[model samples]
Target: MGLLAAFTHTLEITLPVFLMVFLGLGLKRLGWIDAHFITTASMLVFKVTMPALLFLSIIQADLGRALQPDLIGYFIGYTAISFFLAWAWAIWRHPRVERGIFTQGAFRANNGIVGLALAAGQYGDYGLSVGGVLAGAVIVIYNVFSVFILSLYSDEVDTDFRSLIKNLARNPLILSVVFAIPVALSGIELSGWVMTSGGYLAGMSLPLGLICIGGTLSVTAFKRSSTIALDASLWKLVWVPLFGVLGALAAGIQGPALGIIFLYLGCPGAAASFVMAKAFKSNDKLAANIIVITTFASMFTLSFGLFVLKWLDLV
Candidate 1:
């Protein structure tokens, strides 16, 4: 009964989150959301709300435990290994452009709003801190490698080392973590209304963020490239997570942290891949396929990872 209950609740929460995303895609098909709305929502989330959420989350975190570079190293190594395998596989299967776009989908898991909400629910602020750092590392290496590999195979662009480094250096997630360091190190705290209000606002981060995330999906993209979508899905939703388990073990990562970190990497590729593809003049269809396929497929991979975690008594 306990097993059944746990299984049932996991389905209840996880499935609804995914369904909301698909429903957003369906709404897009009905013209309920268009270019204007997506742009506005993205800007609102990125420039303001997202940062506030990050600041609030990080402000309360015990930085000492969270800054465990050993764990960060495991995540970094695992990220590199997964990315290398993805690059190798995609190149063998597709051409330069297609491979570059598809490769990112396989390894660049979503660590955005939805992932944060789920992790916070299960592990509170500590989990968010761990997940955030792990996420930060993954984003850094993923963006660097993806752009570099694509550039190596493609033609000219105005983007130079300086510009690229600047963009990477100012990456929002990276910036959030970096900025939080001073606050964490000062051993200071938010005072009065700042403390009271910030906590409330921070509480808003998870659910509201998930809803906005659901509102952001696009059905049209999902139906665009079945081949790319299917291929990316199979590997991201299956192979990547399996590989992550082995990599985590090899990295000497143990306990609940290992599973949480690994499970996050199993998430579907972010929708941001489309923007990156356009920036690099890569295959947009493949990028959309990656976004749609891996996301839908990840519903399973995430659950399976959790099941493994439970089996191993890790979480």
Candidate 2:
């Protein structure tokens, strides 16, 4: 009972992100922002603003305290398999263009919100940093895999290499990580003024991102697609969590690593799920529902997963 309460406590803290998501959806219903706004907002968060956030965080990280082999191994086992498995599932769902849409539910996740919230609760900033690295790697892999999946599901035999190149070129997170790698090696510190301003800007990135997300949750997407959402809930909410847990354990991670994996595994599907759906012109409805449901469902699994961790005294 005590264990369950601890899990729920953490979950309640994390639930606000969904409310923020709904806030975005509500704003969209009122026609305050549209798809173009979502694109713009996502771009801002992904490229310039959020990259600054990652660079600052990663830069300040105590490298000696960071970098655990078990954590890396766990994420490798958990995220890699899920990344590929999602593609295989979508490919097999052929003829149903909705498969690509549902695939986003499978492949994408609410890592930033759910994972960070839980990581902070469990491992504090240390755990969060570990989770962040894993999340970063997974995001890169996910981008690559999702593109390939879209090609197969879209049945595009001659996918333009230019498109892939452009994506990598424009991605802020990737660029920030690349930039940080060199700076991390250099071991230089940012000026006080720069740190102060960057910190302010970085703070704005997520809350603004959430508010924008809240503004763009489409009513049309909700009303239009039912079956696609059902499929998403089934696989993303249930199957993915199951697979992620077993895979993490099988890969020989425990303690902080295991806790971090559970936090990530318990994340609701990504808010970006809609992006993949629209890009492929697949089941946008299902993708949205999958995002919504998995997010809500995470309140349960996250709590349960956290409870398990608490019982094991990992935190």
Candidate 3:
């Protein structure tokens, strides 16, 4: 594809996904939704619909193709490296209390929400299948890393390993993937009614989650943005994805795999980071700012990155 064609192709994939976000923003501004709605809807998507979506996707996937050991391994290694790099930067530049928040903001991507949505947009069921399995690893790694980092800097936060493990054990998202894996591997078929019902609920997850994300975007947060927040946003939207995509190419990952990696890596800071920061008694406002800035900025960065990938026919 030529430059213009590549970009247009990219937009065709990305625009619908992002427009839901804008719709939510517009709805929120119009007094059609409030904080309570966002909070409740977020919880519903996180706990219920999203899990259903993941389970169905994984269970229906070609386990042999979807369970790419190399891709999963690369994601694990890349995430670990990125976490430590962000942590090291935070410790060097931020105060003791704020170090954890900054580090989390810098390295964590909204993979489960925005990233998965984009992946599905770009690659359809194949994307969701791969992205679903990948999300399982993401949930485990991000939670464990976030908990460890937050605990290191906060006396108020519990640092117990058992608690972390327990939380992860109960996470619906992780549990969904865990259960679906053996089923997919064993070729266990579910009833059509079950699949259909699950599909309806699953279908609601991404759009609802993206809308909540849009509603959660606060202009007030943008106004409160600090240098630290901007720095973290840069890392989230630019540096992390840049290094990650390069590493994937170096490893000979191409086509949809490389594209999926880029989309997930290029996602904005996780909304969970803000909650974790608050729980840890760190700079939550700064965390919020980073989320706002990165989320808004990613509209352009993700498009350009994907366009380049398409232009080069790498994905």
Candidate 4:
């Protein structure tokens, strides 16, 4: 496609995803939904709907063809490097209380929700298949690092490795990917009703997650954390993707693998960052502010990134 056509296509996919966020914001403002509903919905999407989406994506994929070893290696390596770099930067620059929050915001992405939606939007099932694998891998790294870093900076100095392992084992997304891989490898064709039901659940994941994201955004936190929020937003949305895509290209990554990496890199700081911050007694407000700003900023960055990628025929 021409640049103009690619740009249009990019917008076509992204605008609706963002529109749901705005719709969610509007609904919350109009009192159609409140904090309780948003929290509940977010949990439901995270625990149930997103797992269904991942399961469907993986179970239906031809993993022998779709799962690229190089791509997986690159994703895991890039995430590990990014996590340590962000953590090192935080330790070097920030005060004790804010270090974990800043580090988490810098490297953690809302991949399962925002990243998957954008991938599916641009490339349909192929995108979801590739993106789901990447998400499953990256989320494991994300959770492990998040717990470690938060624990490092937390007032409670003792880190529970066992609990972390249990949480990782029990993670719905991780479980979905694990369970689906065996079935996918076995070439067992699910019943039509099973496929239909999975599709239905998968379809609900993105829209519901987007709305919850919108609903949870807090305008009040902006003023208090504007500087840090903007800084984190730039790191999350701009620098991360810029360096990531460049490094991936340098390493000869291309096609859907490259596209999935770009999508994950450009995704906003996850809302789960705030949850982690709160749980660890780090700077929760700062984490929330970073999420809010990065999310709003990503609508532009992600669309532009996709347009550029499309123009270059990289995705």
- The clash count of every prediction, one per candidate, is 0, 7, 0, 0
Off by over 4 Å in 2: 23-39, 87-96, 112-114, 155-158, 223-225
lDDT, residue 118, candidate 2: 57
The TM-score measured for candidate 2 stands at 0.83
* Model 4 poorest ten-residue lDDT run: 221-230
- TM accuracy, model 4: 0.96
lDDT string for model 2 (212-303, tens) is: 65665554555554765766666766677667766666666566777677677767777766676677665556667776667656666666
lDDT of each: 0.70, 0.66, 0.92, 0.87
Name the best candidate (by lDDT).
Answer: 3
Which of the two, 1 or 4, has more TM-score? 4
In order, what is each prediction's RMSD in angstroms? 2.6, 3.1, 1.0, 1.4
lDDT of 4 at 166: 95
Taking all chains together, each candidate's TM-score versus the true structure is: 0.88, 0.83, 0.98, 0.96
lDDT tens digits, residue span 59-143, model 1 = 6788877778887887787778878887888778876657777777777777766666556556768878777766666777877
Q: Point out the higher-scoring one by lDDT: 2 or 4.
A: 4
Sort all candidates by TM-score, best to worst: 3, 4, 1, 2
lDDT of 2: 0.66
Q: Which of candidates 1 and 4 reaches a greater lDDT? A: 4
